[model samples]
Target: MKFTPVSGSSALIGAVLALVSSTSNAADLAAAEARARGHIAAESARTMHDAQHSYAARDVIIDDDGTEHVRFDRQYKGLRVIGGDLVVHSHADGRFKGNSQTLAKSLRLSTQHKIKASEARAAAVAAHGGEAQKVSEKVIYARGDSPVLAWEVRVNKAQADGTPSELHVIVDAASGAVLESWDDIHTAAANGTGTGYFSGNVALTTDLVSGTYYLRDPSRGNTYTTNMSNGTTGNGTVFTDADNVWANGLLSNTATIGVDAQYGTAVTWDYYKNVHGRNGIANNGVGAYNRVHYSSGYNNAYWSDTCFCMTYGDGDGTTFNPFDSLDVAGHEMTHGVTSRTANLTYSGQSGGLNEATSDIFGTMVEYYAANANDAPDYKIGEKLYKSGTGALRYMYSPNLDGSSADCYYSTIANLDVHYSSGVANHFFFLLAEGTAGAGMPTSKTCITGNKLKATGTASLTGIGRSPAAKIWYRALTVYMTSSTTFKGARTATLKAATDLYGTGSTQYNAVAAAWSAVLVN
Candidate 1:
């Protein structure tokens, strides 16, 4: 998550200066500095006029190198803008060099508020199909050429999946039209334990504070677990014990869920460090904490970037149990990984890729753990849905669940990200195990439900799971971007495979064939 300034070499400075001319005069520079120093309202009008852009300064980061990155949130006619944030780069001399923006165009828009704030809130709640627990309003520049002024209505409530949902519903202020809406709760699902629901009869790492042992892992970045007492939010109370022994096979014991959460956290940390050389979720050697026993009758788990923590829910205990399984933990933690890296936007094709990244890594983490109780497979949340021997999603044949797509199609982007992720999941499975069913339990199918016959022409030989996972990790960290599409994913993975195993090696060929088999091309 660290944004290191590019070295201010002559060549780099020249390149940057080429893209941006010095638009601000000395007075403008002073105003910008004043704005950066918290005189935002005082200098807002003058700064926007001088810069010829309606952007409000959000952050000013002065790097160790003589570079200043002034982050700005765009505004249109005195309203805040979303997806229109940009960072203006300048030399130590305050010479504006260039800027980076998520916005695609200028923020000129009709500021007439045809739709009232209450109407926007009602529309957002109606879209959510629930009572809004909280609502806030702001103006945003919707994506595309000539960004339009829209009301960014933020709604927070409990979703059907047992996770608290933060939804951003963008309503056009001038036209009273719904521009876009997306869920902000990035749910996958998490972990610890004396006896995990999945990892049975296991020992837990604890920290002795005063006379009690706290549910903290001393070996893994001091990662710990807390009991939410069946509530929905907040950092719950940390489990403590007079004796070192934690859970005792009692489902009613809140500490039992804590055990599964803590153990899963430890295993996920090990999986990243040992398998991928990643330090932690952010790769900054810092461990993320966990909240267990979240909400009564809850049945989902989620990782929150805002909280820098993961939350697990205690299921209804009949069809589902506590969301503290190993693979679930891995899956949720990988969401943190995706947030740090690529940061794939949580909608459309990129969202599918984002979800798939977590599923792929989560499965690998389970395999890497090699825990006998939870045998590693291409199934996600399998332990959570053991009552019917079903899973949240299946990587080998995603369509087996009757929701996820097994292969890509022209309208794949229209599907829910959880379902669209099937294409990439199937691709990863094919890349690791091959289309011939070698070392695999079964063969795969295309989107058209065509049973893939393993003939010599269409058969493929895999290059092993370890290499496949490494290539994917490399692609995610090095090649992918925020707006990457399925086509871009193909190119990114191809480049990663080429970088790792050469241009025409078996690994590279397998990656290409796998994507092709999944209809990505």
Candidate 2:
């Protein structure tokens, strides 16, 4: 979002002054030259607003020429600014004036720029050692820095028997950068709607399906497996053309991983929209980019602020496909959402809380999607493991999984962020359910002690997950911050519940007892 200063004759002059102000006090010619370039760039956008859907521009910094500038390998085709004007500073030309119009549209700036998403995708695929013509096209949406455009394409290469081979490309529209690709040949034909990327292979009827997902590229073959390793069912790798790669190695082959990834994303989008009235992650009704089969044998998934996209990878086949699970997708994508909003740090106790917040929302999305492929459980990393016998992390008893800590302590930060997340997880469970021991309820329960157990401890039962989740969300958004700790979380939730339900109310008092049971002062 660009911020355009008020425009008038004087405003134009003021913009020029702002441009010149970039380096007025520079002592050296080198510094002056650097500021000149910086001023021009800032001045270029000074009078323009609504660049890339109102992405505000601030803290303009200019680098000195001869400062060893680095450029991306792919060349820029053109500059397209949406919702505002793009002011170009022509180096090779006769005199140009303010708001000048040229005979060459390509040379001049326009309100919005339209590019061939398919063409750019093909170029990126070819750059990555794949044929462009044989690939089928899908969604082409705008993405991160340099105003990138992302396109999906499926490969149509035939084998020796004239059978179609699997391949897919996610190309960058502006620089034609092959951002990522996937491959795994599924026999299912493409479903006609919104590019048919993963719609055919994975069922969306709210039941979760698990299988091996694969991606093919001329460079190499990448495969990943989901939680289902029974060998009878196969997701057939919906993309058939995209590859999965992680920092560790090749992830197991699992079908419907893409569908799972997309499903998780859809659920998250809907949860925020229907539950919180948010349009998308940024609350702008814009779709975010998602990449499945990120790396070979990749054991983890991540949300990248740089690319503004979410990536998933298959897990160890025997344990899980970290990408195919709904909670995992929601967890990673929530990192993106959190970054856009609270921008939580991934370190120390606050970091543990950050991770736990993702788990909280992630698990919520799972239940929201409520697919049959995987039953929604109040656990964070559970579905990623193929064992199916054990959960990755549990909210009720996080320590049971062997990774998470059961209780919060000052030293919680010393534990792995994933493992340390237990404290907050447990806190949330207690907040929602309270302290009840005998029955081992599907959800946790709380025992509220009023007046030293004179009435045999009046146990305040929970009002189910619906209202509980709202309290947690409100606390996270309105009260919690980067420095929030376990105790802070306790206070935040109690405050949120009291604000929403009223003080001394059963809901508010139950929330208070839940925190006390968790040992949060």
Candidate 3:
């Protein structure tokens, strides 16, 4: 291991050159950058092999194409070492970086590590609960680097009657590094208690039998699955010990699966199928899966494509069950639908649209799931008592929250994805529900311009959630893409409506008017 200091310009040159230079010292140059990046600080590396392997690691590999491969703990977490020096950046966050300079820095990793997969796995297992067994080894051979070994360990524990709890582990092939791990710990007491349905193959099953609720990932090969039926709420909701899912009593279900979650899942499932005719999240008839009772006191829910499942948190106990709202479930599950279909990159306008898409569909799902138990509402997070006041989001009127946008503006990009989502949410509301003036069905009035109106205006005011959802579903699943913006969404939905009903039909005209009302067109 050697160190060299270069001018700032030279550092940039070296970082760039590491990509093009095909010399034997290329690794040295990369290692120099890695050393500079504090990948292997002397203090951390000083006691290597003498006693304990105090491993504080960072990724410092820059490829010839200038793509950076970083393994920083704080940044690029959840990367699994496959073979050789090659570690697989499996998570979506790991694969892409919005900042190129940060990426460039990762590319300059010149240092080589000779870590064995078995050792890394043992360390990881010990760090975790250490309930692992049958640790098998494999080699991770990457091009132009030292080989990395990995271990495929299994956690084969059983319930009282010996029902196997099959847990899987994928460690660094070269150095026993635990890259990823998953296990199903608890089962539900009743089958139907936690069960909800998603479109086509996707389903949200609260394992009342397993005492958990699951968002099934109906994608092929069962990539990302969630197992969270811990005996107590929030007790068991992690796919891996390294995973963090925000769970609390937000939706407020005991060990019993929250009812709103079931409504949301069912509605979202129905919306996609009935409206867009999507077979499921994957559009292949295979359904997605959901799991409840994830982490202890978890407050947020997430749609994980890696597990092909959706997860809900109990919320802050005193507040809400994140899953107890139809809109929330629709929102999370829509994320999965977006991932499988458009694979929207969550940044810029695309990111905003992606977030808005969730809000839009979630709202649509709410209306679709018009259960007598949970009346359909235009408000988001209404069921979950987040702020102890209103829903998590609002579509008809975004400015209702000081945080969200009421109308489109250039600065919307700077807003959080959720807040910026207001634009799209508003657009959807206006499109289907129309400008609320007179004769609207809304409990609340939408004030656009100087006009304060109900949800129903003219015959358009009577257009219920079903028709509007149908058109929007078509736009989202079939017409919209990852790059869609607010304006683009308007056009897509209008086109969808026209295609569904004749262009001359009132429905198409209504969609057009709604888009106009929202000022998206």
- Per-model TM-score versus the true fold: 0.75, 0.51, 0.51
- In model 3, where do residues sit more than 4 Å from their true spots? 1-254, 258-267, 386-388, 437-462
Against the unseen true structure, what C-alpha lDDT does each candidate score? 0.70, 0.48, 0.48
Give model 1's TM-score versus the native structure: 0.75
Q: For each candidate, C-alpha RMSD in Å? A: 8.8, 19.3, 17.4
Worst 10 residues of 3 by lDDT: 186-195
- Which segments of model 1 are wrong by more than 4 Å? 1-122, 129-149, 189-197, 386-388, 445-457
Q: What is the lDDT of residue 356 in candidate 2?
A: 82
Better structure of 1 and 3 per lDDT = 1
Top candidate by TM-score: 1
Model 1 clash number: 10
Q: Return whichever of 1 and 3 wins on TM-score.
A: 1
Model 3 lDDT per residue over 156-217, tens place: 55433222344445555444455544333211110001212211212333322254334322
How well is each residue in 1-521 modelled by candidate 1, as lDDT tens digits?
22222222321121121111123344444444443423223333433322223443433334344455555544454455555544455656646545444455444555677777788777777776665535456565545345676677777776655677767677777766777776666786321111225687777878998888999877777899999998876799999998988887577777887888888888889888888777778766678999998888677888888787889888776667777788888888898987776667677787899999989988998898888888888988878853546788888878767778887777777888888888889889889987656557664545443422211235666778899999998777655655567877898899779867899998998898888887777
